[model samples]
Target: MTEYSAFKVELTEHVVHVQIDRPEKANAMDAAFWSEIVDIFQWIDDTDAIRAVVISGAGKHFSAGIDLALLASVASQLGQDVGRNARQLRRTILRMQASFNAVDQCRKPVLAAIHGQCIGGAIDLVAACDMRYCSSDAQFSIKEIDMGMAADVGTLQRLPRIVGDGVLRELAYTGRRVQADEALRIGLVNRVYADPEALLVEVLDIARQIAAKSPIAVAGTKAMLSYMRDHRIDDGLDYIATWNAAMLQSEDLRIAMAAHLGKQRPTFRD
Candidate 1:
């Protein structure tokens, strides 16, 4: 329901659609854009009506990366005072990183519907999502190497988990543009559509499928998966047991049992 200068938010049937609106800049992210994105995810986290989120760009490109002006401004500032500027730069970068981290931390699932160019910061954004769908015209690149720095955002950490260590290294080291087909082959994108509109339709269909599931189960599963990814197997099992001990008693389970016995749909109340 909230509108931002760089993005727009809408909710329908428990799915929140977030679209980047800066077509003129190929949806490049500035400081304000990152701040808005963080706020949008926070809004989703606070709203019970929103069960899932779909992210896409408004025009031809999903995003071209960080806004060139923003990058120039950062570089200019860094040159002004190396010591003081370095700390400020780190803080700014961490804030931007948290914007994407919020997506991963959000209890609801997030699906990225990408098209055209998805470069640099855009890669970070999609990497933070639970799922990704793209159009055939989409192109992906790490781009930080070409920009004279390493990617300080979430991509360097998350891309390896999405793909593999080798592929992540190759992409990060070379900064080459990977087309939609290549991205699909590398398992970078979940599905590829003929175009943006088709991609959006498919993504929404997927979102609806997720929305129909028990919210407690979906969120618990997401949490367990995230935890397991970083923890040892024994630790993960212990954590899952502790998690399920509390979650198994939810009304959804009772509804599910009744629905199975009666051969009817289970209606869940938020």
Candidate 2:
């Protein structure tokens, strides 16, 4: 219900649709974007009525990445003090990292509906999502290297696991665009639609499927999988065993069983 300067937010049924609103700027990540994204996802994490989320851009492109003006501002802020400048830049990078980290950390499954160009910072945003679906015209790039810096956000840390080391490194090194077909082949996107409108329909259909499931199970599965991604096999096994031992008792399980026996769809309360 809150107004956002950089995004248009809509909640219908149980899925929250978030669109980057700055079409004129190609949805570039400016000051409002970097800070508002962190706030939005943190809010999503706490809202119980929400079950799934879909992110897309308002106009042609998903995003053109960080705004040049913002970068110039950051450059100006850097000073002659070697130790102080390093510390300041590190802190700045961490804040930018947190913007997308919120999406990664959200308990609910997040799906990205991408179109046109998904550039540097845009890549970071989608990398944190649980699933990605793009338009046939979409293209992605790891452009930070060309900008004289490494990708310091979720892309570097998260993308290698999605795509392999060879693919990720090649993309990072070359800063070349990966078109929709190649992106799908590389496992960067689950599916590619004919266009942005079609992309939204399919992504929303998937989000609705997720929203229809038992929240307890979906949230627990998401959390467990996220945990397992960072932990060893045995550690993950033990963790899930403990988690389900307590979480398995939700009323939704009983509802699901009853629905199965009655040949009906299960309805869950938030």
Candidate 3:
């Protein structure tokens, strides 16, 4: 995998840990930062060694939305030629959106371990993850309103699916910060730890647990769940049935059945 200045990537067993490295900037998203995120996930997809992933920030905060300097630079560039700049801006935004989309598309489950502030684009990142855990000090907000725009990224769409339309509306419209307790109550975070260190330990433990499962089964289940989320019930049923048809023929199932019959733990290939 390529070395990234804005992020760090480490692989252990079957879990990939990705940390935002720009602590001085509160891990803010800039063009290079988003590019690196997309690259790392693509690397994960290419490498069979990684079966699950955990994401977090390096500093006190998870992220502080878009970098103010990047935003200013784009705004200044837009003044040069409105029409051309508008198209360029749209393309750039879409590229950044693809970074988060990679998390959703990854075959392995992606878990977010958030701390401090997770606002705007940070919310987009977490929303794309398969599950979220956070520190008790973590706070989240759909901060696009504060930036004078509706969130154009995945947050507006994905967050509603996670927290319901009413809750999403209240938060997005107001841009008010939601503490970890409130996030947990609304199902935004699955668990909250006392602090960042504890949060890291808990999240990594969860990741390792997930990594121990049969890779084929885990990947198939993740794919099926994602399909079900966007499809009708009948369609989802059909899809799962087709998936199972192929999956049932794998050696893992035979191994699992034999292990069950013998009252022993099943071993699976990574």
Candidate 4:
């Protein structure tokens, strides 16, 4: 229920809808954005009533990436001393990176509903989500190469896992615009809708489905999947064994089993 300058956050049922609200700026990531995102997701992680999230942008586009003014501010602060500038810039980059890391690390499932232009840092943002869906008009690019810099955020690290090395390398190197169809073909998005309205409707419905599930099971599933991304299969199996040993004791399991046996709907307690 907290108000945010860069976003409009609303909770309905157990799903939280986070919309980037700076339409006049194409929902660009400004100074407020980087800091507010981390706070919002942290709150989502701590709230038991919230079970799922759908993030989308308001207006004509999802996002145009990091605000140019913000980037300019960083450039303007560079000192003549090379060592000091490097140290300052590195710290700044890490801070921005943590903003998206919050989305990646959130225990609740985060689904991105993208439309129109999803460029540069926008790619990095959506790449951190558990799932991505876009409108037919959506176009994505790894725009940092065109801006005379390497993508310093989560894109370079996380996207390769989502879209594979070959496709990611091609996009990163060329900065070519990938249309909605191509994005789906390359696995950048799970599905494409005719328009932003349809896109949000379906994605939010998916989030609702996720919210209806047992929160403990969903969290464990996300944790196991995230863990397996870096660990070996055997390690993942062992980890899950330890995980489920504790999770199995949750009352949710008994409630779910009783509902099944009684042929009735299950209602889980937060």
Tell me the TM-score of model 2. 0.98
**Clashes per model (N, Cα, C within 3 A):** 0, 0, 0, 0
Q: Residue 105 CA error for candidate 2 (Å)?
A: 0.2
Clashes, model 3: 0
Alpha-carbon runs more than 4 Å astray in model 4: none
> Which residue window of length 10 is worst by lDDT in model 4?
208-217
Q: Model-by-model lDDT, in order?
A: 0.91, 0.94, 0.91, 0.96
User: In candidate 1, what are the lDDT values of residues 1-270, reduced to their tens digit?
Assistant: 566999988889889899999998899997789889889989899888778899999889999989999988877766566788889989988888898889999999999999999999899999999999999999999999998889988999998999999999999999999999999999999888998889999999899888877888888988998997789999999998999999999999999899999999887775
lDDT by residue (1-270, candidate 4, tens digit) is 799999999999899999999999999999999999999999999999999999999999999999999999999999899999999999999999999999999999999999999999999999999999999999999999999999999999999899999989999999999999999999999999999999999999999988888898999999999998899999999999999999999999999999999999888887
Question: Best candidate, lDDT-wise?
Answer: 4
lDDT of 4 at 245: 95
Q: Give the TM-score of candidate 1.
A: 0.97
- Estimate candidate 2's RMSD in Å: 0.8
